[model samples]
Target chain A: MNYTSIECASSTSEQFVPMSPAKTLKVYWLETKFEWLKTIRNPAFALPAILFPVIFYLFFGVLMNHGNVQAASYLLSTYGTFGVMGPALFSFGAALAVERGKGWLDIKEASPMPASAQIISRLIVSMIFSLLIIISLGIIGVFFGGVELSVFQGALLSVILVFGGLPFCLLGLALGMMLKAESAPAIVNVIYLPMAFLSGLWIPITMLPNFLQTFANFLPPYHLSQLALKVMQQDVGDSVFTHLLALTLFAVIFFVFALVAHKRKQN
Target chain B: MQQVNSVKHSDASQVVASIQGLNKSFSNKQALCDVELQIKSNQVLAILGSNGAGKTTLINTLLGRLKIDSGEISIFSSQPGSLAVKQQTGAMLQVASLPETLKIREHIQLFQSYYPNPMDYQKVIAYAGLESLQERFSKKLSGGEKQRLLFALSICGNPKLLFLDEPSVGMDLSARQSLWKAIRDLKNQGTAIVLTTHYLEEADSLADEIVLLKQGAIIQRGTNEQIKACVSSTTIRFTTPSYPIDFNSVAYLISHDVSGKYTAIQTNELNQTLISLLTKYPELEDLSVSRAGLEEAFLELNKDQLAQSKTGKSVINKGEAA
Candidate 1:
């Protein structure tokens, strides 16, 4: 109950001013940096996104398969894409759902920062996770898989999967916006794990039942895996452009769904 | 003659924010009914109400989180959600939270990036009393500590207009004093603040203007003195000596309850009534006087509303308060 307005008045003499509103680029960069720290530090994103793919590769490609270089190289692309998908989906879908549920999203809505900064920040974090997954898998491929590939091919595949992570992120975002926080992880898992298996990240599509193999062509991961395989000169069932087009279409569809869900929430 | 219009008394040169005939509803039950408010720079306006009194709704409406069904709101001459307004405004919402893993300093820094002209971290920490907890993770802090960190984030933007919904609800007495001090400094710096609290004494000490809300309506709005003046009656309670004192014979007595051993009297004339009471019953023991405090005024205004609310379920359309 101290009414010391006089002391505060004297203390308020400093010409303290807020800086100009942050530019869009600065907002994106800062948001990414903090968001990256958040994503990397969270056991939810880090343990599964980085460790799962690396562990899987060690088991199936190294110890189980006895270091078959060609098989190892082929599995690397699919598993890298698989690793990338987990973070992209969970970060946007599950993390966003929880943030929204916790009322953090409402706080940002009142902030001066650009709305798209949230979306872009999540994307950047997911891509960073994708890079980590690819690199971790690459190191594992070299040391354990006895895989040998040119630097250009490895970098190209990494870039491909990194970009390929987006569609799953969009899918996660749509799920996040539509579902409750408690339901998000369950829903993302239902979509993520099944999609990874159906799209042949665990096994080649040709080895599956004919109908399942045919169905794999429709899934974005299948296209992503196909493109990565094509980069390694593996015999993909479809043309490179077909896989690219399929992935692009998936991105567009999921992106639209996420956009619509966001708009709906705003209203 | 007294000038009765609250809006007429507001300084024309210093309107920091205004709401014109704001009306909002959820489904059929109207949550806000034709609410009008004008806030001036450097003034602290407390929105006082009990639970479910639309305090959070008004805050959310001003912050542009909930769309008002009707009426226009302007902050610094711009729309509530517009960039011009948002840049000049900061809010610590009732149910808002921070990222748990981030350290206190990290939380401040993140919110700092949102504003064009944010105060330095040193000023923010000093004012918010967050210096000691700077390195602590947000998840590890006590509820009061978390609230202080949120306050720091709100002020770090150097906002010209600030909205705090029950800012010190969970804080200890010392922490509460620190928060009030920070708020006072911000006010001294010419920040316009809108405060909502159930603590009547908080409103009594800090508010330049108080809006008493009931059932989504502005039942009373004015300065501290003006509000107190609205309820002119005072009460005198005393234990009687079982003597039949004709309380009605006392002039200025509005009403009196005379029982076997007690008498309670209400009147507008305090000094005259006290003199008359002493002359009539010098033996009157345990005498005490009570003025119509803000809590009484609030209860008086919302007596019917409370009765109606308790009889049945209040429509729960405004679920955002959770």
Candidate 2:
């Protein structure tokens, strides 16, 4: 509408300066911060994510076990695995699918936000949820179930369970890219509940039938729960390297699936 | 001559982005065909077409969301999706939402972090008219308010080039007016803008140039006045008189329609047609003569395309309508 003003304004803002390292870091930081804030504020997601495993453990590990330390400690490892999987799976899988369907993902992609920031932010949130779940379960196990553990063993178990959620995160990422928004929650639940049961996260592999016990080897959550059990010396006597290798293999497979889905979406 | 002079004056530096012979297809359906476009600084180019006319497809290709099959797309002399191009570009796409939990100010703050040199916080809020609603969560906002928030995010970077696709779709009149004012301010700030809208009046008021697309091909390209001039015929409407006059003798008459009490005549030669009608009936009441607006011109152009298709004719002679 105004020609002179346009000519004047165009002259001043033409350069495309590169971002500084500090500014780039700030972008990642702020992205993660906002992502964390959004997730925590949603009661539907945060409430179930933090409370489910804690409640399940309090019921099965304490009230039913009647102060049996060995059962409490073993259930702690399994329930911790169960706890971490919820956040890692739903955050990456369901949230991502909704974002994609809403065109929110497209908006972010069109901006200068680094794609890695998105993935990294969700990973951090999942781990934070895992930490909260493990701590709550830990408090219940110590005070109610009388499970005994040195500080070192407790810390190692926490570290294993928190980091072991990586494979599930990758699996969720792959599903998120593939699933539609309206059906994402339903589909994710279908996959999650069965996988958790099959992996012996709800009950120990030894308690299952021979055929089902053998099937646990193929599920990523089984390997993660087994790794957590190793800290309590209650694992099925496999070397630590075996479980780690299995989780790594699953992560690699899921990562490839995620990559293929992402590439397919771009075209 | 004026277009040529404007082109020569702007030179290569003013051309922010260019698409040459672009072609894209989805399976058996072609989404774009041999498209060529140039986005110049300080200008608004409106792409107008009906649904499935490839407007969104073209915008997606420019945003690098869809890959073109054959063509050259250079934005800031780099590839479309490159960080360098994205840094200098902003877009307000047709989206269903922002993250529902985040407040407006939080969304703005997060988006601002994406760009290296972001606009000031207060300035972006003022430009998008989000001052009063800054504290509200995104999910609580109405459709128009959400559109405003999306607009704010798009301009958070103070981008040199902006792509707005149906930006005013759900906006109220006052909100739409403010959006237009903000667009004008951005244009004055030298932002090269590409707008696609169904509202012809919106395009007419904001666009320095308009591209009419049909069935994935550009049918016409010109300024508002130039495009309107393509229709040529003006309409003359008057109340029917008691005496029936022979209208066939009217010079340069395109058509005449008598509906109820009103007689409307369309002709290319406005002066001769009015004179002939007035001479026949000295007491012509409620007479009005008006040229075709952009909406009429657009429909006329599309009607011509339909006629051309039925007759097995081709009108792909680019820039001829101008």
Candidate 3:
């Protein structure tokens, strides 16, 4: 069959013909902003992600433990970790699973944007949600719980909680890749609620049974909480290196599983 | 607007996409066999098949969503899914679902940003007849509305090549007609299209070329008329006034449905059979020739194997013959 390629060269006039890094960056920014918008607008994710930790803190750290300075500082650090963890896991973990199940991921794969742009956007949005949670908790802590910290300590704690969401994001990725969309929310809750409590994010591990405290030594959130607590001079557990190593190990493990499952799905 | 990377070629036939020796499998079931196809610019190639017939796999491979086990595929002279090809290509996949939280306009704008050069968002909305639903959340739209939105997103990139997998699956009659008009407009503007659908009339109306896939292989490929004619035989019907049409004397006679008033005869060598019949029965009256419909041709061509796979999940005549 003879085919005439008339006007084939007209493709030259397209704006981003070469797809420069600048344009790629623009794609990342666009995806991130849209994702952030979707996150904030979704009551299923927004109400719980933004409000739950603050509400929980007001009830437990501020009201129940009113005028208890030590408990206020400890619970403030732990609740911040708990708060940051919800959005990270729900957004990356449950959202990705649902997106994958709905075939949205496939549509994304077929688009002109780079694959890394999708991940980068999700990561940035996760960080932003974590920041909002940390800031919200900080205000509630300073005013109501009377939890005090220097500027340096506050900055360090903010940094830890914001970035500390990474391991959970990786965990969510693995779960998203491995589990069904319907199962993701239930499974995340299963892992999240228990891990938070077991790791002493709800109550200090020191106050828990000795065996439970020993068990906290192995959990990622325990390390994250301890690092957050260190910001207020309230470190009750492992050395900073141990916490960092444990978190790093979880991140690596989750990352590997996510990569493997993702590859398997595509193949 | 994103400009795809340019690659010079000796042949200027504007091959929008091509695949050679393509093969893929899932576990023990082969999803795609050794398939080779070429698509030129401004052409619409309709892939026709039932469920599990490798239609989805072929579309997925072309879009670079699934890795080909072994084969060579290219779009615009670049590897499939390469940035250059991606900039110029668009797809509405069979399994795709849009985010419910986004409004119609947001979805279109977000997808348009992915491309370097895109049609104006308003033009896309106008083309898709999505003007009224622009500000409405996607979750509020009906099924047909969602399909239209997806179609709009696919074309918003000003893509040179578009893949629409059952693009009208959930559309109402009016919406489907409007979608067809939008697709025809794109084709008129020189966009090459690859469409897969269960609707035979869709292919008859839009496809410049048609490929009939059965069990991961192309059983037939041609223009609409050519495929309709290529079903291996046609049935000639006539009512004889005096002399009877003799079936034994005619060549390529496969069978006959003879009645006292009228008769229908099947023959592969339709011309020869007609010539013989005319010679034998000069008084034959009320004569007519009818070729099989594309749907019947499809079913008959793959009747044997399709009868065997026998799974009833997809659109079908399942387990009937098995």
Task: Compare the candidates by DockQ and give the number of the best one.
Answer: 2
Model 2 — TM-score against the truth?
0.90
Tens digit per residue, CA lDDT, model 3, B1-322: 1322332231233666778889999888888888878877667899998998999899988887789889898677667777777888889875546777888888888898888778998899998999888999887888788888888888878888899999998899989898888888877666789999999999999998998787787767788887776465688988745655556787768777777888888777889988888887766788899888787567655666555355221223322221
Can you write out model 1's per-residue Cα lDDT over A184-224, one digit (the tens) per residue?
88888898899999999988777889999888878888988
Best prediction by lDDT: 2
Q: Report DockQ per prediction, comma-separated.
A: 0.29, 0.42, 0.34
Where model 2 places Cα greater than 4 Å from the true spot, the runs are A1-14, B1-13, B237-265, B269-287, B304-322
For A76-117, candidate 3 gives per-residue lDDT tens digits of 899999998898888888999989898888877888877777
Runs in model 1 lying further than 4 Å from the true structure: A1-24, A68-70, B1-13, B235-286, B305-322
Q: Candidate 2 at B175: error in angstroms?
A: 1.4
Q: Mind giving the per-residue lDDT tens digits that candidate 2 earns over B57-102?
A: 9999999989889999878777888888898889999999778999
Best-to-worst ranking by TM-score = 2, 3, 1
Fnat for model 3? 0.57
- List, residue by residue over B95-125, the lDDT tens digit for candidate 1: 5456777888887887888876678999999
Q: Estimate each model's TM-score.
A: 0.84, 0.90, 0.85
Superposed by TM-score, candidate 1 places the C-alpha of residue A247 at a distance from the truth, in angstroms, of: 2.1
lDDT minimum window of 10 residues, candidate 1 chain B: B313-322
Candidate with the larger TM-score of 1 and 3: 3
Query: How big is the positional error of residue B309 in model 3, measured in Å on the Cα after superposition?
Result: 17
Which residue pairs in model 1 clash with each other? A18-B117, A18-B118, A19-B116, A19-B117, A19-B118, A20-B116, A21-B116
